[model samples]
Target: MELTLKGLHHVSAITAKAPENFKFYTEVLGLRLIKKTVNQDDISVYHLFYGDEKGNPGTELTFFEIPMAGHNQDGNNSISALSLRVPSDEALAYWDQRLTEHKVEHGTITELGGRQTLSFRDHEGQRFILVSDENDKGVAGGTPWAKSPVPAEYGIVGLGPAHLTVETAEDTAVVLEGLLGFRRKGTYPSTAAGQPDVIVFETGEGGSGTEVHLEERNNLPQEHLGRGGVHHVAFRVDNEEELKQWIERVRTVRLPNSGFVDRFYFRSLYFREPNGILFELATDGPGFATDEHIEHLGESLALPPFLESKRQQIEAHLKPLDTRP
Candidate 1:
């Protein structure tokens, strides 16, 4: 049986500090901090959830903020970058200056996909790209970030699709198109976004939202897994049974994948494409509120039942932040 992934879900990253990460994504980037908690397995570290108002599934960009996490080199076995789409060039310029004024290090605006983009790094060194798409899907349903300079109408819709840079485009294509159920969306000329060949896919709609891109960097540097490096790219599946189908299919192709991980809100299985970039098959069930109420999200330290015993130690280690926007 084939596992038809619904679409690209949330992207998780590794961060070094909670306060700095919160400040950049929520304050500078204007995303909402939806959940505040610690990693269930290792309670010493904090797992942060940032996204649109309700912390919707796809718009969320979660992180594990480990103190002084070392940096990784850019090579194979890592995700090079993740791109978030905005509504227009005005948004790009707004982000460019806003980030600069906050003393955030960033690069110049470049033209890509027929739009201007502003590139910058968060405190953890993860590089982010903001592109202005004229016909992009507007932000997911939710209240606006109170401090967001960008109006609620033009807030971040979701992942403009993520970039997986690989050594050989040939091997990566087979899995992207064949196993993952992604169709060839289109090609684009080189843009300021820094990739040569841009091939896009849509498990849902091909509009300016819910898409993923495969960037072929034939002889470029490989990415190291460290601070700022993406941990994994998760594809949305309907439920646990769907996730199981994916596990079986991936194994049929002789690919190695981990068993289903109960992530509280969703179940997941992880596998890598030919180029060693990590990919996850996650269910879109029992969402964020499976554990707490939507209005109370991120208001307190939430621990999974198993990790409740260690909450005291976990709370002591993490530096508290004024999570209020």
Candidate 2:
């Protein structure tokens, strides 16, 4: 069965410390901490979900904040960085100075594809970029980055396409087009987003509004997976059965994968493209509210059904986020 895979679901990463990771993304970057939970297998560590107010699938950037994990070095065969787009070029200037005033080391604002872009690292060297564009609809946080030039009304539009540097272009292309069903869109002006010659692809109608990109950079160092690095890139599938079809298709290609792990909210199937970048296929169901009440989500430690017995011990091990901090 040729499953018509949907677009990107969410990107998950590993963080060194839960408290610090929470602070940087929520307090500094202004993303909402939507769910506070633990990994079912390893209850001692926290599985934090950050996103827009409701934790929509595409808007989320999940984390496994395993305490005491070492920092990871980023290179090719890894998701290099996540680019978030702002409302306009004017917003880029706003974030640039705001990052500087906060002592958040950021590269100078530079023009790419005729649009202004700024790059900065989180406390863990997780690089983030903000590009000013009119077409993006990325959700912004409830609170604005204090130095934000754009008002909360027009904060970040949405996740701009995530960029990845693969080991080889051809191998990666096969997986994108043949397995993932992504078509090679068209080349656009690098000045539009200040990017290198980016090769675009999409489920359909690719544009600033909705699309994902695979920018191949060869001769790069291999990416190490640990603290402050992307753990996996997930794509959306219709449901569990559809996901199963994908699982079988991937196996037919002789790809190594971790089949169907129950992630509490969604079911996940993970595998690597030929270039060795990890990809996840997840169902869009039983979301954040599956356990906790929507109104009071992310307030306490949540456990999956199988691990509910360990809730108390998990709570005891977690270092309280002191959300007010």
Candidate 3:
């Protein structure tokens, strides 16, 4: 079967403080906490998923908590910034004012890649840009959370172009195009003085949700991955059968990758491009609602059946997180 990746599935970042991360994303940013669970690979830390009302495939922005992680030392060859899609240019104005009222650090609204954008940082200095969907036309954005503190119009709707900063653009570009099926879109000027223009790439339906912006900066140091650093970016695959086909494609290219692995809510395949940026291909279904009622999601600790027998031990290790509304 022909293999094609849909678009941005999710972007996982690291955080040192889970409680602060929860308050910032859910209360200040107005995203719905769709799942409160532990990292399957390490069971001791929390893996928090934040997104729209239902936590749709393209909307999820997750974090893996590491209480002792150091502050991020930003540099090259990393997923530098993450983008969150808001409704319109008018919504950017609303967010600018809202962020100020909450004492959060953010920048004035400006244009990037032919779209209005606002740059900001989370508590841990996790960089982000809010892109306006005013005239966007590809991979539709997800539904906003009805209970979000911010008006639905101004609430974050979905993920957008993940900004990648690397040492050699062509190396990463080749992997994106040759290996991942992304097509070159266009270029935009870089904010850094005397640097080359940033190249844009898109996959699947092609819009803010399906784009990646790559920038080459040979002078920057290798990034020190820690709290506030993005862990990886995931692309959407239709199902397990399609994912199996993608695994073969990656293997054919001779890239080391994790064969089929189940995450309960979805199945996934992991690999790293030549530039050392981790990439994942994830299935879209049996979603978060599989183990909990739609309305009760994120309100309590949720364990997959594989971990259900060990819930007592797991809960003991977790810090109490009361997500009650």
Candidate 4:
């Protein structure tokens, strides 16, 4: 069976403080707070979703706000950084000034694979990059939030290349190529000794959100999940059938998987790759607008049917979030 992931569905992470996380992404970064809900498994914690106006798949970056979680220890078997795409060099310059004015720590523009990138870190020390792509095909793929402080033309064009740290690229490379239909685009040498070469891979049409760069760090320690750590990175599939096909594919290869789990808005199948980074394959259907009206998204606490009975209890426990634009 042949399969090609459309792009990233969403990148979910843990945040130590809810207010700080909300301020950075929505206020500073100018993303829309699309969904306000609770974690399905853990009702005490908040599950917040930020994205473009419509809360599209590739544009989403969700978080589990765990106020007491410790800082993450960076190492192998983890996603190192999340990248977002911008329209042009002018847009990059606009972001450079915006981040500076906000006193967000960021680096000057640098070229990576012929694309200009601005590296930065969030308040919680999560690494990120804003890469410029003049000919971005996904520009019209998402709707920009009308109330974003940043101008519409300079708004984020969804996720870009993500950096993954692995112990060895060989086994992960095999799964990426053999199962996920990713092709090696290029490679670069590591800057330090004992570090393995960096391998770049791409799926779909190969631009912006479709790229995944793998860095090998054999001598590094394994990562532990906490605040600022990636919980899981999800890839998009067209519908339920395609989702099922992937589950079969993973099982055929004898990979341990969480078979068909309904995530309310979308169905999901999860499996840890050979390198130990958790990956989720999710469907792009019945999105964030299913329960709430489009205009009122993220305005109130939305709950799935199973959790509706406990809405009163859950609401009492969650910190009141200010999600205004």
Q: Between prediction 1 and prediction 2, which has the larger TM-score?
A: 1
For each candidate in turn, give its C-alpha RMSD to the true structure in angstroms: 2.9, 4.0, 0.7, 1.7
lDDT of 2: 0.71
For model 1, how does the per-residue alpha-carbon lDDT over 191-253 read when each residue is reduced to its tens digit? 435657677666755544456666776556767577788988887788888788788888888
lDDT of each candidate versus the true structure: 0.73, 0.71, 0.95, 0.86
| Stretches > 4 Å off in candidate 2 | 111-116, 136-151, 188-196, 208-210
Q: Name the best candidate (by TM-score).
A: 3
1-325 per-residue lDDT for model 3 (tens digits): 5567789999999999999999999999999999999999999999999999999999999999999999999999999999999999999999999889998899999999999999999889999999999999999999998999989978899999999999999999999999889999999999999999999999998999999999999789999999999999999999988998898898999999999989999999999888899999999998999999999999999999999999999999999988989
Candidate 4 accuracy as TM-score:
0.95
For model 1, the stretches where C-alpha displacement exceeds 4 angstroms are: 1-3, 137-143, 146-150, 191-196, 321-325
Descending-TM-score candidate ranking: 3, 4, 1, 2
What C-alpha lDDT does candidate 3 achieve relative to the native structure? 0.95
- Cα lDDT tens digits, model 2, 204-298, are 33433234566666556788787878877787777888888888888898899887788878898988887788888888777888887766667
lDDT of 3 at 86: 96
**All candidates: TM-score:** 0.88, 0.85, 0.99, 0.95
What pairs collide in candidate 2?
A: 112-191, 112-194, 113-190, 113-191, 113-192, 113-194, 114-191, 137-157, 138-157, 138-158
Total clashes, candidate 3? Answer: 0
